[model samples]
Target: MALEAGTVVVDAAVTQAEPSSPQARTERFAWGPVLCLWVLLTGWSLLRVPIPGVNEPHYLGKARHWWNPDWCPGDFFLDSSNPHLVYYATFGSLTQWLAFDQAAFAGRAIGLLIVALGWQRLSQSLTGRRWDGVLALPVFLTLHATGNFSGEWLVGGTESKVPAYGFLFWAIGNLLIGRLLPAGALAGLAVSFHPLVGLWGVIAGAIATAGVLLQRRRRHDLQPTETTYSLVNIAAAVGLGVLLALPGLIPALQTLEGGDPQLEHAATQLQVAERLSHHLDPMRFPKTAYWFAGSLLAIWLLLLRDFPNDSRQRWWRWFVLSAVFIAVVGIAIGFGPRPMAQMPGFGWRSSLLKFYPFRLGDLILPVAVSLAAVQAVMSWTQQPSASVSKKSLLTAGLVACVIGAISIPFPDQNPSRLSPREQEDWIAACHWLRDHTERTAQVYATDVGWAIKWFAERPEYVNYKDVPQDAKSLVEWNQRLWKIARWRIAVMADGQVTPEELADLKQQTGLYALLVGRFGPVKAKPAYANENYRVYVLP
Candidate 1:
């Protein structure tokens, strides 16, 4: 069950290449790689104007008034203490102190920097190769350039996962090295930032750690008499984890009452993504899911079956364990809950969670393939074995690259609500509202309302958080905002806002102005019309 002599030789070389002493580690700390990745991912965020559609306003609006978070006017995200409270406090304080429209851009740059550093450190730890970090830069960026745009890359600006994953990768590296206390603390902060992704990280991490212990046990190596830090280590790890997680956990538990029912009710009310039909119908196999999951599983099993059972290349086993756990959770989420999405006016049904499992699988596939390819190639270089050859290594690399290339669901453009020009138009419209509207005026805007709330410093008729808000009034407002805004934008009909509907909305919602796009209804009388947009004050 020992590592093949050839693999052992590769490990020896890696050990010689990596630094062991504290001062040496500092010397080897990677800056060039981080700098390269930061520049690549944030070019649009930094050098060019900030791209608007990635929900920048949603988070920035919360930061707009740090001391007070206005969740679409009167409502609030925190009835008491909330996880986002601290996040807003920190980000809001910075945005106010610096005072710029590109706060989200700066925040994203900071997030990418953290990710770059964390990725460098974690990649080296996971693969036991210092150079792998340098290579991973192009690998990760290339995936985005050629990634499933809707699934992997965010729709809007840097969402919570950007920072959350930074901490998550670092935490997992620590967990694998048996440094439980730091791992616990890092994992806690990760959760505080974004519960959904962080929760998955925690679950996957625990399973990876347990998988190691299980492997040891199967080899008859878990005896109490053996020299090992077992129960004591586990206790300390759990204690630190709970202590560090208190900030996120306490507020979450406090707010957990009736949370599920609210979520269920919200799911029923919200519009399901049209693509979700592929997952709901048994006849329509989950092609996206199968493509990624299949690639990941195939490579993982290859390592397990081919590599020596006790090979020092532990990432393979860890990834397999984590992938299995993620798959199970994804399956449960996809199939367990009631349908969260549906085809409007159609009989088909799909859960919001339905495609998530596949999404997770897709995310993991690249990392798995990349890791396996690099390590296998390295193994072949060192091993004088009959089991592997140069041909096998090239084949693996080609396969991984192909999978990554194909997984890119959208290659032509990124996933955003507006193009760069349209984003400028929206920004111009927001500036107009700021200059003209009363401070307390609640305008009627669509998904662009979040931007209005921030830039215009005025309330809008609705928001897009049906998943969180349960109040009958807010829920209705949320639904109406989409229906009204989309209707005005000609979502359903031939780009026309019927006169009767517009009048009824103005009377009911007290909407003072209609912020119309260039393609909006012909009847809109422009109080202010720019090249990109037109705003009509309701008569």
Candidate 2:
């Protein structure tokens, strides 16, 4: 008579005659549609962007370095403290056999496929309809692409988080169907891939579990429609989850320890205020972010208005509300007792904000809206009292077509975030450096972003985009940036660099070569010249 939490209580005789149980529906699940969805998702994510998309270099570059430390030997960021050892250990080996670009393409393909399959199953579990995934996929993509409070993206790019999210989705699907052990295992694997992402999923699952227990308690006095899970079941779920999460969780926690409080405080300030302001500081978000928040509110309102509450779906409600609660807490902290907008000093405020509270909401809110919208439509269509009209159907069809057309993935014109001519020149310069320069040579390229070490296969003095996570390294990285800033200011003052200035720059920074913009005048003759950039040898 007693059932574990999340287990559906089915009447055997009636369900055997109708074959309408959740298990029966799952047994009839078809893979053909899931495969088709996977292909669509692949095209949209992998084929839509060029190899080495935004974070590919950031993550893949580190992956390569982890496998072969000799690679970019003196690069500070690559050699800095690593908190994602599990990700490196899992994916870094690909660099041994394939080129960086090839490995990136392969990783993207694999990650996208996993995400598609997981999403399809998650959709089916929520609605108990196979085709609901097909209908909701485009909606999820639209809402996700529109805008978000934090700069978090689930799809696109080859990174640890992509596969982590895929596993998280699968865990949610399992949790919905009362498979706690499997859910815990999958969620644990998610944590191993990306601790922050996996932890969010774990937290959401915990919230759902609590909701299940409370709902069961509420119904205890009434006719026992469902029985509460034994304490053993709860402990088992938590124990399995912790066992699986330790690999990633331990490293992530270690990163927070053994840091100078003053230095860590400064690092947090730099992260929240300067380096990652767009992601960490809510006040730095653009108008589009606020608009997206309003759209999410509207979606929530519509779901409430259209759908009546169902006890079976209580877990889903609590799961989504957890994300909303996190975002609300983030907004409150962002504009709180002292207000981060005023550039509050280093303290608990900056420390808490640095962990990125809005990230989970960015992904979860859109997912909730997408599923709720489709479910509402299905409910309306099934209503016996509601009469459907041809004109209304036609209007709905038109709207769906418009949404589908907009969701079509197109190749980016500037995939590298550079113009074609500029990109060509940049690659040429990198290739030249790879062949002509020494492997251990230190090169400083102005505004090269994340690709210099990836392409040139050499160490860099410092990169603005690739900051180290540890406090001591971060402080050192900031010093290098200040050093670069001072040199650039002095050299660019006279619209030219004098011999004395070049000598001082070399002595101050110990540079073997300097790559500067083509328009910037230099006192010495360039070693190599391209239309967009010039590589200079430091005296």
Candidate 3:
């Protein structure tokens, strides 16, 4: 006999039967533990000292500029370049609110919060349990701990890739809940912050949209209202995101109008695949591949086997596919001919630059960590029998937990942290520039511009190879300057200019002050000397 919705069917002889109550249908949200875990993870990521690579000093400097009321646009050390203004504005506002050191903790805090929230949301969507987010704790620690010594500008800071990752995860969470509009909006916001992150968003969004379509097809009786609402919401969210990003858009437009010469050269230079290969270290290949594969495997196990029938499974499949695409693209670049030339948009051959726009492979680690956690949860929920040995599984989980805990403390040395003495000298130089120099002075220094900007009381000029300048003229000017300078400060490991080259540089372009380290060879008498640095005023 069929049981009716409101009526309960019981055995005829049974004298008593318990009725199901409304309370049984209510869902419980576990907020307390999740919030605690978030707080703990955030604190751990923030308490560490800033590592040297990835332009930490540069970002700190930008934060200082944003925090200062006296500073205006165009005062940054680099020639007129516009960062995603919304992030800067938010950081600036938060610094004011907290009354903290804008360079040190205040700016990083915002990134930390965003990362934590995004991880929490992603975990919720993947595992349908809050505890599963614990797996992502290792990922958060790894990203926060890994310092960028590669001398690339985009690799570093709270404003760099970190926020983009946060936005990506947030979009994924919204997509999991059938919230396409909000997902699109999050993706739009991410693009405004970092245009490259749009690739991840597009991949994730496509998968989500496909999932919705598949679900509708599977359930033929489903109404169109849900689909229509989702589409409309996505459009609205994107529209609102655009409005939010207007400040960045306007400045970018103004910058493009002026036209940077270096940007043009960068576009041309990056076209060679050989240049791109130089940036990637062979040693990192194994680790990168491991993480990528692990994440994919975890996602597959969780969504395909455990949650095969779940509505959100299709989106998970799409996420895995997107990750795979990123990995495959990276491999192709690693092996293919005119490899750099194949990259889209920038130029026919411009993808060889160290910081190629769409090298989505960098995201493999985080995605893997996220999926691992989700898989663990799925496994936990699907345990075959109560008698099955939980001891071994628990031990494995504990081991993973221990490994993650230890990994956070072990700093990788590839980027090489500066010695304490070097750090002091660097800080001293920044302070001197900060106290000295006028606000409007276009102070040019090689190699130290990013750090100098971070420590400067005002903006000063530091030339970056990638800022987009006129290719023909700027390249010639840079070559001439390289001959005179005798020392290269722009890209680390590119090798110092030879003495003969310096003489040629002096003959070509009037060489001015040279900021050399304590150990840097000094041929001529320096105008000023300190324990850590010597300022050689060109004759």
lDDT of 1 by residue, 1-539 (tens): 01111122212222222244321242244667667656655663333223443456566665555555443354332222343544565565556655445677667777777676666656665665665655544454445445441255422265566676777666655544445556666777776766655666665554554555455457664321222344555456556655655665565544434545665455434423322334333223446645645655676567545543332244336644575666556444444333433334222234334323443344555655555555555566666663555657555665564455434444223323567787677778878887987765667654444356656666666655312322344345556656665555553376566556667667867887777664455475677877767777776
Q: What tens digits encode model 2's per-residue C-alpha lDDT throughout 454-517?
A: 7888888888888988888888999999998988887888898876787887898887888776
Error of 1 at 456 (Å): 3.8
TM-score of each: 0.73, 0.88, 0.69
lDDT, candidate 3, residue 113? 58
Q: After superposition, how far is residue 110 of candidate 3 from its true place, in Å?
A: 1.8
lDDT of each: 0.53, 0.72, 0.47
- Model 2 TM-score is 0.88
- Superposed by TM-score, candidate 2 places the C-alpha of residue 289 at a distance from the truth, in angstroms, of 1.0
RMSD of each: 7.7, 4.3, 9.4
Single out the weakest 10-residue window by summed lDDT for candidate 1: 1-10
Model 1 scores a C-alpha lDDT of: 0.53
Error of 2 at 213 (Å): 3.8
Cα-lDDT of candidate 2: 0.72
Residue lDDT tens for model 3, 507-526: 44444344566334545565
Q: What is the lDDT of residue 347 in candidate 3?
A: 47
